[model samples]
Target: MITKYLAILRMKYVEMFAYQLSTMVWMFGTMVQPLITMMVWMNIYPDQGESFVLYFVALIMVERLTSAWDVWEMDRQIREGTFSYQIVRPFHPIHWAIAENIVYKGLFLVVLVPCWIILALFIPSLRLHLSVTGWGLFLAALLLGAVIRFAMSFLFGILCFWMNKVTAIYAMFETVSLFLSGQIAPFSLLPPVVKQISTFFPYRYMIGFPLEILTGTANSHTLMIGFIGSFIWAVVLIVIISLLWNAGLKKNQAVGG
Candidate 1:
């Protein structure tokens, strides 16, 4: 099983490498939004402490690592009947999406790491207060964040089995995520009501909570709350995805087979 997954990862890496230029272009596109947000915030809140820079830089990294565009791919496959090939495979189709997610991010990091180093060096104010323990916790939170984000996206993609237009559904998800996931701004900088509301949803855990840990903005209590919230959301999302996948499979078999 492990070997199969590794093969899938390698296959994805090779495919992505074959179109490295396009991959790099997409990486730049991803960077643009966060870079613009960082610049705007820096100018608007020039007096804000070093934490501001650290937070946004961490936000950029988290955004790059945790992003999942598999929904679009899955939607295309389902719509085009390409997904039928996966249905007959021994493994679940979702594994392909998961492998693609890992490969895409790993490849993008080859470019992202140097860019990050340059940003950190050129920007004197962007200081990270990272401890050994914090690094461990931050990685754990990041993994959980990635899983939650992937599950949410895959679940939405499964909607393609029933709906003819999944793009609008995905757009709505992205629209809400932009405001609630701290992609627009740090949760701390949001209005009080918005901040409180963000905490209640899984969106913050998807990106901002991990960024808070990485930037040393989250205290012990906040970290504990984040971990608990993230775990709950992860489990809930997993269950939801499983149920949706089964339902979608049945629907697909009924309609297409």
Candidate 2:
């Protein structure tokens, strides 16, 4: 099974390389939103401490790393009847999505690091301050965030088996997530009620918690709470995805087989 996954990963890397130019363009497009947000916020609060810039920089990295474009690909496969073949394959279809996710992010990170380094040279305030323990915790939070977000997205994509408007539903989700996940602004900067509410929702754990850890803003208590919340959400989502995948497969068999 490990070998099979490795092969899939290698295939994805080759596929990505074939479209390197387009991939670079897509990477640039992804960077623009965060860059613009950083510029506007920096201008508005020029006196804000270095932590402010560091938070946004971490936000950009988290966004790219946790991105799940597999939802669109899953939708396409379902719509075009390509998923039928995958259903009968020896391995599960989720492995393909996982491979694609890893490959895409790995390529984006290759481009992101050098670009970020150059930007950091120009903007001295972008430096991050983290202790050794903080770095370890931040990475754990990031891994959990990525898995939870990907599972949520995959479950949503599975809805295509029963509904024709998954994209519209996904758009609605994105609208809510943008504010709740700290894409619009740091969760710390949100209103008191919103900030408290964000803690209960999985959105903050998906992006904000990791950013907070990276920026040295999350203290010990908050870190414990955030990690626990992330773990609970990850388990819930994994179960939900398993149940949905089984149900969706049955529904597909009835409708198409």
Candidate 3:
């Protein structure tokens, strides 16, 4: 079973790489979001402290680097009423999504690192304390975040089956996440309500928690708690998706063999 999944996952990469122009667009200016955020925020916090810059610069890059809203694709498949195709297939629909995620991020990360170095040079206020231990912890947390994020997306996508215009809900959630997930600023700087509530929200787990740990702000104990929280969220989300998909499969209105 695992081997079959591995094979399918490999083919997803080949398919993604076939689109050269799209791949180029993804790599070149995808970093623009961070650049804009950095410029605006740097103007706001020009001399607060170097730590903020270090973390803020890394925050923009990390947020941009980790960004994915697979819900759109999920909603598309369901709206086109083609989700039945995946249901009849021998493998989980999520397997393909996972493969797609790996391929896109892996390919882009190749180019992103060199760009990170260049950005670090240009932005004197930017500082990153990259160490072996920090990198290892960050990678582990990142992988966990990916799983949780994907499951959340899968859930949002499935919601379209029961509700009209659920995309609006997802968009609203995206707006909240941008602020709460440390994508705009450190979670530390947020209001007590924002910070307190963010910990309960999955977006903070998906981005801000890992960002703080990577930059050495959350500390070991808090980082452990964050990772555990994220892992548990991923598990719960997967379970929810399984139950919903089972129900959805029974109601599938699309044709299939």
Candidate 4:
């Protein structure tokens, strides 16, 4: 399995760089929304402009690292009957999606880390003062965030077997996540009720939890709740995906055969 993953990673890396222009375009393009959001927050609280700058820049990094587009891919593939090919393959189709995410996110970190260091040199606010343990926790939370996002996407993607509007459904989920997942503003700035509500949903665990860890804003209690929330959601999503995968495959076979 490790050997197969390594080979898939290599193939995905080559495939990603094959469209160098598009990859570059996408990498830079994703920054626009976060940058714009940063500007808005800066304007809202001019006194805390520096803080807003750091938050949104980190937001861009976290967002790109955790973003998943499997729903769109699976939607088109299943709709076009191309997914049937993957279904018959020796390897599970989910592994291919996971490999693609690993390759793309690894590329993102390589590009973004340097850009962050460069920016930090000029913008003191971008500098992060984190201990070894803090960094480790942040990375772990980030990985969990990525898994939650990927699992959610794959769950919605598998729904394409039964529903033509899985992409639309997933879009709705993403739209809601923008507010709940801290894309619109820092979760701290949200109303008390909203913050409480967000805790119950996986949206906050997907992006907000890692950003909280990275920014060093989470208290011990908050950290405890965040990890617990993330773990529960991760387990729940995995269970759902496993159940659905079998049902989806059976449905696909019946329809295609």
Candidate 5:
């Protein structure tokens, strides 16, 4: 199992770096949204005052580290009935997904980190201070966020077994998570009711809560609350996945191999 997992990681690593130019392209491509945010915030504060810089830098950190849409891969497999090979394999499909996630994110950082340094140089005024402990906590929160997002996305993808096409449904889920997760904007700036509602959902903890903690915007009480929130989401998602997978297996019908 360990060897198989390693092989998956190795293959993903090789695939990630397959084209060095493509790596640069994707890095710059992903930078657009964050850069646009920086521009808007910069315009809002010409002299580099206010939360613009903090928000901009925090977003930069967020985009550089974010992963997306392994659900598409899962759906493709399920749709084509190729997932049966995975069932017969010696490992869980989640391990393969984890390997792909790790390899791709690591590869992305190779491109992302340098852009961050360049961003700091170009906009030195927008630097967000990240202490070592701040960074440690931030990384933990981000990891937890990734796990939560992956579990949720994969769960939705598995739902394709019972749906017409889960891409649209998964997309809706992603969109909701994006807003509720605070990817589009800071939750603090959101309406009080919105914040209240987000707290009850896993969306906030998936990305927003972690980003808040990373930016040191969360007080100790909120941080503890966020930790508990993220924990519950992870556990609940795990249980949900267990139930969904068993049902998906029972209902699963195949076309070809």
Candidate 6:
């Protein structure tokens, strides 16, 4: 399995570099919204400008690290009948999606971490000072966030077997996630009701939980709750994706028959 994964990673690395320009463009494009939100928050509360800077900068890092694009990829592949190739492979198709994610996010980390270090030198607000435990917990939450997001995307991707426009549906989900996942603003700044409601949804776990940990806003109680919530959502999403994969394969076979 390790050998297979290594090979897949190599292939994905090559594929990623093949479109190096496009990948660079997309990675930087995702930064714009968070930066704009940072500026707006700075304007709204000029006194809290440093806080907003830290929160939004951390938001960009956490968001990119946890982001998933499998839904769109699988939607197009399944719709155009290319996904069948993956279905027939010796390994599960989800593994390929997972490999792609690992490769892409690795690229993101390579670029973004150094950028953060550089920015922190000039902008004190971009600096982070976490203890060993805090760093460990942040990494743990980030991994969980990535898993939940990938599972959620794959779940909707497989829905393409039954629906003609799964991407559109996933787009709506992303639109909601933008606000609920803390992409639009820090959870601290959101209304009380929104913060409460975000707790019940997977969106918060996907990006907000990790950022909360990194930004030092989450206290002991909040960390406890965030880890538990993220774990529960990650498990739930993975199980649902498994169940849906079987059902979708049956549907796909029926159509092919």
Model 1, residue 236: distance off in Å is 0.7
| Cα shift from native, residue 32, model 6 (Å) | 0.8
lDDT values for all models: 0.84, 0.84, 0.75, 0.91, 0.76, 0.90
- Per-residue lDDT tens digits of candidate 2, residues 57-106? 77888888888776787787888888898899888999988998999988
Candidate 1: which pairs clash? none
- Model 5 is weakest, by summed lDDT over 10 consecutive residues, at 48-57
Q: Is candidate 1 or candidate 4 better by TM-score?
A: 4
Distance from true location, Cα of 66 in model 2, Å:
0.7
lDDT of 4 by residue, 54-95 (tens): 898899999999999999999988988888888888999999
Query: Model 5: per-residue lDDT, tens digit, 53-86?
Result: 6665666566556555678987898889898888
Question: What tens digits encode model 3's per-residue C-alpha lDDT throughout 1-257?
Answer: 77977798789878976896877786556557655776676678777656665775566556645666678876777778777687678888877777787777777677667776787788765546768888888888877777777788778887777766878898998888878788777766778888888777789888887788777887767787788889889889989998998787666666332
Clashing pairs in 2: none
Find the candidate with the highest lDDT and give its number: 4
For model 4, the run of ten residues with the poorest summed lDDT: 248-257
TM-score between candidate 3 and the true structure: 0.87
Q: Could you give me the TM-score of model 5 versus the true structure? A: 0.88
TM-score for all predictions? 0.93, 0.93, 0.87, 0.97, 0.88, 0.97
Task: For candidate 1, write residues 1-257 as lDDT tens digits.
Answer: 89999999999888987988887788777767877888888888888746666776778789888988878887888888888888889999889889999888887677777877787787875656588998999999999999999998888888888988887888888889889999998877899899888877889898999988887778988899999999999999999888888888889842343
- What does the lDDT read for residue 39 in candidate 1? 82
The root-mean-square deviation over C-alpha atoms between each candidate and the true structure, in angstroms, is 1.9, 1.9, 2.6, 1.4, 2.4, 1.5
Name the runs in model 1 displaced over 4 angstroms.
Answer: 253-257
